[model samples]
Target: MYQKITVQTKTEVKPQTTAHLAQTMTLLNMGNGEVEEEIQKNLAENPALELDEINRCAMCGSEIAFGVLCKNCMNNQLKQDSQYLTFVSTREFPVSEEAADNEDYFEDGTVDRQTLPEYVLRQVGMELDDREKMVAASILTQLDDDGFVDVDILELASYHHIPISSVERVKGLIQHADPVGVGSKDAREALLVQVDELKRSKDIPEWTEKVISDHFHALLKKQFSEIAQQCEITINQVEKIANFITENLNPYPARSNWGDVRNPQENEMLQLGAPDIILSFFENNPQKPIMIEVFQPANSNLTLNASYHAALKTVDKETKMKMREDLEKASLFIKCLQQRTNTILRMAQVLVEIQEKYIREGDRYLKPITRAEIAKKLSVHESTISRAVSSKTIQLPNRKVYPLSVFFDRSLQIRTEIKEIVEKEKEPLNDQEIVTKLEKKGMHIARRTVAKYRDMEGILPAYQRKEKVKTK
Candidate 1:
């Protein structure tokens, strides 16, 4: 008499895929020491996995010690720059033999340094209620070392099971923190924040924010006239605002001072073992192929236990099943390691291409590169580039140890370039003249940029410099 309807639902099961992804993310964020520790743990847990003696080089991919370039690659490199690319393990922790024997670690564990996020949270806590504190904490965890908002406000709200408006509200409030541009997602946003702060104190020119917000790229590219026309302002006004930004605002933050990136006690980067990837460039080659090498420590050399595999055939069904599962887990772990190597290699290859000038010439030539640019070029997410470079270091031919973040540093490098130009000049070059010289060298800097950099150097203007020279 009564009709009923049947309802059906399908549940998707992807345990293997999900587990692979979870492990991959874990490996991606791991530093060299952590990876070695993980490999040791895997060997201990998985009966089918065995540690092997690594006979081949992880660097330069040859049959030799992986710490330095093999003889064959070394000779090839010598023919070009005559500089052998060497990668060595650096101690990330300050521990003596006695400290090592004792359970007590380095002072880094108990250091008191106010990280940017911690500083921000305390400020937010002073103003916000209990509910807002929760949202602010979530936001704090996602910030990069330079104090930029690393996640989308909407996505964060959705993920945290909070309203979108709540996230946006806190984001706006956080952007007003002391650094002026601390919570920005990118350069324009940071500059805009600075501009806004200035506007609140004094009436900035109406077109100032417009030029900074819209034509920042053009500004970076040194298209001053274009920015002037677009903003419907005079070139002189553009020069004034440009000078203001250079003088009054920070274009980039020193990440080392940021609490999250540095050791809380030392306020420096973590020292780690051999670089994950070593890049040896063929300076002579027109295409400039770089040899990307992975450092293979003894602990990281993992292989399948052949003895265990052979024993599988003679075991009972339950034991054989268990062996197969362990084998699968070991294989999954190995695959994650292989993928990690490939991802690191690709990231290093991109770095070599982008920082070729820095590698071939000196630190002066290191361009203003960003993870976004690298991600765009590599067709990966920006987060991937960030994770790949987070705790890594690249050893250059000059025998200098530089963190991967050095490639992304623009302001300090540009200041160095300006100082070099002034030192090399026969006479004191005026700010306008310095700008021209920098333009010729592909810097495209504004005249205000020269004045700002010179002032930071505590060097006088052209007239003052000339007067001092005459007296000398």
Candidate 2:
């Protein structure tokens, strides 16, 4: 049997403008800074458009600079709502033992932790030969926050082009230096050395010594019964030995009393310079719209004088047209910059609204969201959404802020509710337990899938979580 059929349907394909196509192409190909630069160039070329400056407070006409805030108005506003305060949480390092000294080394009589490395070298002095000192100095350089040399002896030896035995000898010498535990390889070694030093001054029992050196695993596993059986002692004796080990252990065995400190590396900051525009979610309220400011040149208001315009009119027509084109290009640059800011702010507002829950809470409450969802909602391609989010930070009501890209993650099979179920389990819940719980809630996920989520969350297996009640 042979059959022929023809079907026709009318469809309208909307044509894209040159400007729209250019904007889309730029968004797809360029980074945030490049896109911003392109916008600035366009604004510089477009003469008709001018960037408005906010020299005074919009609410109360008072001159202000440095920030958008007018001093008196801001102070009054803060005083009016004293209860609504902002708090910023920050991380700080604990003071080291060396800093406790009252000796006046500098103007404040306190040596900065940053100067500790040089201080240690100066204290050590030129007592030993240069070679031995170099070896010792090399070991000191490798010391971690706890003052112990965290790297392997062989690795250090190879790096320094010295024999492993010589490296070990140098490390030993350094370990016996000012900080008793300095230059020791790892936690276990550091603890053992510190224990041995203490033992030299006071008599430590054989059981305690055995627990530190031979039965460290037992102490870590908290296997009191096994430790008791091995040591031919009761559970109480094993507990005492465990306590002794804990008391003797130097948790940060590498940290020396010297003032050496290091600063954390800074994360990259994104900057966009253009005139200011505010994007507001509320249609009726314009006063409290989201303020978007484009930074412009200080002398942006200065225009070509009347004399210069008259001089330009006297010039040849071809030269005058070229001059006009140049001015137009600069003005166009400015317009593009404004448009870029507007687009970014609009996209950011949409994202903030969509991820309100995550903004309020944090990672725990983060929903499984994607770029495509946002793109569809915004009536733009997925690539547009990606460009809008890249290198952009959104400030939330709670003073909580995060990168827009943080919201766009791969969908998770384990939702917040399921995660809470796993977390709230009385015992250490394995993948099987998680799977069972999910099934009970009408979510049929495999044990392997549960395991995958657990792994993603950085949770270890059940065997590792098992803790013994006694130490040998």
Candidate 3:
């Protein structure tokens, strides 16, 4: 008989190229100013890297200054009347000293229109009736930053004139919304909800829920040996379950609620600076083709130092090795920078193509799109698209600066609809009446959501509006 031997093998996964990773780290996620700062930092550190005296436009190869397109190519682009033209420029609007000093005013969560309560309400509101919605709203609005319910259920029930069971039911519904555990009473409750959600779709370890529910304190303290003793499982099994929980679940659900995208507060601040991209109509007419400009920090070309290369041959082996390393680093940086520009140009073209009407018109015309959809069109990872758009502002043809993320805000169209509906209301309509109107217009949303959107627009409720109208 042939001898049977059991062999173990290690599987090696190939990693991304250094150049690709460098590109991603250096330029893919950086804003215009941040990219400029990175390039300047590299230039200062690397003797082998130098800025080209004769800067050229990447498109037409015409000589230009640092960070911008040649004037001739720009004129030709406009004269051609292309549907949309993407060019690189460094021109920026000057921000006031007061604005610079008060950057915190923009970055702080105060101006964020998409509050967590509003976001959670959008998710859970549709399943609730008026009373349940009020309860849900009360619970959601009172949540701490971690998305845990901060208020007492008994007090809330008393205030709303509802049974404690009704409040409990509403809280249960809220807990099951996206992010899975949001609105839970505490971290333990949040983790339990997440485990329940995981169990629905996939087979988790049999002891996962038990450990989370019964031995949660031990788990939190990482007393794996004690948990193993109590649960009668091996320490290794308990460790694996711990690893699974760490990988899959979050105790603070609100922190990761939006996925890879920036939270609403960050989105609000992103629009404060000079726009990274500008869309303008040809010859100042909306009927004409749109000119799209993607801004770069520098107009000059980043190039390798020829003198540094020449001196490398004359140096000792030690110095020559260092010089060669510098040359490689410089070349990689240049390539990555170019890749960044190309990626943004391609993305800008796609955006203009899909959202041309919205660019020419207003928020009412915004076509709903997701980063994933754009990434699919561009044959890139969704996170790549997210990084490209993050912290970048875009100026529309109407001279208003908004975050590039505004292109993907799915709620904009509905919010616009609500504004229009409210604007044209014959009498001040209640949220349910507004919902019926929206249903007729092929838009469906919950009444509470209608209330939230109306609140976002600073519109008064039906009774308040009626009272104001009577006063008028």
Task: List lDDT for all candidates, in order.
Answer: 0.64, 0.48, 0.73
Model 3 bad stretches (over 4 Å):
1-16, 65-69, 75-81, 92-271, 470-472
Q: Give the TM-score of candidate 1.
A: 0.57
- Give the distance in Å from residue 49's predicted Cα in candidate 2 to where it truly belongs: 10
lDDT of 3 by residue, 1-472 (tens): 0011111111232465755663654477667766877888899999998887765666666666654455876677668765676676654445545555654434221122354556767887887778777677656644554677655789768756789998888888788887789988798999999988888898897699899999998897789999999999999999999999989998877756454233343333333556778888767988777887877765326778999999987999999999999999888787677667767777888888898888877788889887778878877756567567765678888877786777887778888999998899889999999999999988888786787678757789999999999999
Candidate rank order under TM-score: 3, 1, 2
Model 2 scores a C-alpha lDDT of 0.48
Q: Give the TM-score of candidate 2.
A: 0.41
Compare candidates 1 and 2 on TM-score and give the better one. 1
Residue 22 error, candidate 3, Å: 4.4
For residue 239, what is the lDDT in candidate 2? Answer: 86
Lowest lDDT sum, 10 consecutive residues, model 1, at: 1-10
What is candidate 2's CA lDDT for residue 318? 94
* Per-residue C-alpha lDDT of model 1 across residues 366-404, encoded as one tens digit per residue: 788777888777666565666677656665655454566
* Cα deviation of 34, candidate 1, in Å: 2.0
Please, what is the TM-score per model? 0.57, 0.41, 0.62
